[model samples]
Target: MDSNNTNVKSNADTILIVDDHPSNLQVLFALLESYGFRVLAVQNGENALKIANSILPDLILLDILMPGIDGFEVCRLLKAKSETQHIPVIFLTALSETVNKVKGFEMGGIDYVTKPIEHRELLARIQTHLTLKKMSFSLACQNEKLQQEVYARTRVERQQALVGKITEKIRDSLDETQILQTVTEELVKVLNTDSCQIELYDEKLTMATVVYEYIKEDSKEAPREHLRYHGKVRQVIEPIYQQLLKKIPLQFVSTSLDSKYTKLACPIFENGGSKGILGNLWLLKPSEAVFEELEVQLVQQVASQCAIAIRQARLYEASQQQVKELEKLNRLKDDFLKTISHELRSPMSSMQLAMQTLEKLLQSDYPHYKSPKFARVLEIFTSSARRHNRLIENLLMLCYLDVKSEVFTSELINLQIFIPEIIQSFSARIQQQQQHLLIDLPEHLPLLSSHAASLEHIVVELLTNACKYTGPGETIGLQARVTDQAIELSVTNSGVVIPEKEQHRIFDQFYRIPDNDPWQHGGTGLGLTLVKKMVEVIGASLELESYKGQTKFTIKLPNHHCTLS
Candidate 1:
């Protein structure tokens, strides 16, 4: 072997040479070393196996003829063991027989060299096998990297899917306790924790209470006692609660009286943590198992959903309370109205009866003493009694309508007859007010099928309003006509124009037009409101228009097949 061929610097490829002849080992070692290859020469198969097991060289060259164990046995042993199985082996021998070469290959020899010696040929073979081995190792490493990346991606997708499931379950409920309970159960399963719990803080942030908890079935630790601790006062774990209130998540190893465990606490907040803290979510696992980053993020996401559910449930409760309060107030109002009707109407009836009796006595028994002054006093008393009676009736009617206590019975009403009767009831008042009354009942008007009493009250109220607002000699007209869809009845009063701005509110209960009552009518201000309510009860619509010293109120009753016939 020539030592002058040392152009190649130190290289990393190592080769193990196993030969029984010392001379062959020396020559091969010097040749491989001159080419910058790390060489290890072992004389026997035992040492060869030992060195190969220790260093796992890039390639091995074994001689066929040996003392204790032949090259064939060594190659078979190398291939049998998993550690050195991939190393390429080449047989070096002086035997030129074709049978020996074939046997060498069957024993796991990759190539064979039959010679006195051929150094360049051997080096060429070594370089080729080393290149193949390096390429194989590089490919194996790349394959492992790709496998790891794929596994990581799949894990992330699975975690995201679980988060979506937990979110859906929590959001489906509006009950605060139910929402919290669901969150704890789902978190324990998803995070593989020994236990899970949710603790809510008081409004003042001075105390915390455990609202929900879940423990794994086979967990060795006993269930944690329900917590109701004052912050920084009662419990040693108060600092954890304080940290969570500050919107920070914490992971720590907690040593309890029984055993040690790991815990993670995340704050529950609304509006991306901008609002006040609602509560905290807690997860616990055995001390040997640690919480991962992805698990922490999952807890935080679920906590946000829980906050939303809690807020919605609280709002719903508040609205229910308001509705109850309003119902209570309505009941009280109805009771007061009933009491007034009973207490006041009885005396009003007696006064009217007494006045009637006095008039008859004066006309018949005291005919000689009848005088103008006495007549004026009698007239004044009658007028005030009548007005007082009307006010009581209006108030009672409003109460009935409000409570839906009045049941209206529908009947066929001939407008020709009905309108005239309503007008007749108000005829005396119209005359007393000095208002000119007009009637426009077309002979061909259709009969109305509706609640008769409601219709009667509606028409009477409208006519009374017209008579009150119309001045002396001003026209107060009651008219009825047939339209394509329904029968239209309208009440019009001249010399009074209700302001456009106040017309919309005229039908509101107790709402009076400002500066519009010049007659000091002293009305209860419920007449028009009563009309509007009665109109709706009878399936009619009312429209008001006032302009140019004239005001009109039209009531359209739906045509329910009650034609003129």
Candidate 2:
């Protein structure tokens, strides 16, 4: 044994030696042991075969010309069996004849040493064979690892493609039943399971219904169509369902009375599992072929897609219901408005005519009774009638706007003339409130091609709003200016500031600024809302700015419909 050779050391490499002579065995064993090789010695070929089968050492050294079952026979037997074939064998022989050496080599002996064995030559031969064996094992391990990696990559690719296909099939429809059915069918086909089912829990999660299921024709389990699991079944599966609710996927081998099957349960949830789970996806195979980790992950991905489809279908259903409800409410509202339009207007018109006739009779036939108090009473009666009429008109106008039934006919108009006329109508009310009115219309203002009635209604509502909120001696300003994009018409009032937060909501129907109406100029709150709608109808935009003791409502009429006059 060469001690200086780095490879010859006590590294736990085992070598078995077989020789009939005890002296030869002892000498060989000592020499190999000193070089740190684990040595096992036997005297005959039969024992050699038995020990080789038991320990399967890294290397074998055999002596030829033994008593029975010679070295050639031992090597032949070792080579015949599959388990001990790969162990390297070096034959020790005294006969140096070419014929015997060829016989040994044919029997699977790797190398033969002549009987006057050189100790160093034997050790060197053993080291070479050990190194070769280790190299062979390392190569085999590398090849196996490479094969496993390739298999895993292919499987992942296949899984991803299957997920895409399942997603497409499930999302093809917005109907809940169809979507769930498609999911069950596709999962059964893709997973090759005996059956696939989707069970949806009620909102309370106390009840579950098998809404959709697909079973192979030859499946062992009985078909369960539209089964409602409650009471006993529900209680039995409560633990499993609880795990699913926590978004933990489950795989288990479930045994029935006669057969055992594999089952997988994956939860379906909304909003990336943050929301409550909607249901569970169950897959079953007839045999005890446990679901692999990759298969579980694939099911989870499909479950996420199922969650989205379920949510979308539910949202679509909810929206359809809401639309039907809105349509019904709109019809009722239309009927009420039509009835009020007729019933209220008839009496109001009659009352107006009777009042006019009575006023004429009092003036001509009874001049003595025409006192200031009587005149004041007539004024109150007239104002009350006008307010009631205005309320009715507002309601009808809102109804028309809501249904988009208001017809708009566009015509050219000069704002320089049109705006002032609108202003003049509100002049009497402004004077009565003692509020200052400021007009800022340019001389060469552009002509607007828009719906005259819509524009008039918008201006009137804005001016009315300005009049109602402006305190006595405060200024109400109506200003018009041209910008590169449009004509800007603004109604600004001083000494009254709208809160920033409320400005955005003032245009909402029936909304009012709390405690901001000092004069109790009570209104239906539809004025600004109507204005906003009319502005949109005429293809203009409205904005509000209220700060620093001033509130301004600005309407921008686009320049595309404006011409220099």
Compared with the true structure, all predictions reach lDDT values of: 0.81, 0.84
Instruction: Identify the candidate with maximal lDDT.
Output: 2
Looking at candidate 1, the ten consecutive residues that score lowest on lDDT are 227-236
Candidate 2 lDDT over 403-522, as tens digits, reads 563466789989988998999998898899899999998888888898888888888888888888889899999999999999999999989988778878998988988887757777
| Distance from true location, Cα of 234 in model 2, Å | 5.8
> Which 10 consecutive residues of model 2 have the lowest summed lDDT?
227-236
Candidate 1, 1-565: lDDT as tens digits? 2223346445557789988888998989888887788788999899999989998988998888899998989999999998998999988888989898988888888898765668989999989888888898899899999988888788778878987898788776777778877888888888888788787877777767777777777567555552222222223256666677778899999877677889888888874555798778778888888888877877787788788888888888898899999999988887897789778999999999999999999999998777999889989899899988887888888778844524666777887787777787887887887888899998776667787877777887887788777888899998887888888889999999987778788888778777665576767788888898878877789999899999999998877736565
Whole-model alpha-carbon lDDT for candidate 2? 0.84
TM-scores, one per candidate: 0.77, 0.76
The deviation in Å at residue 438 for candidate 1 is: 7.4
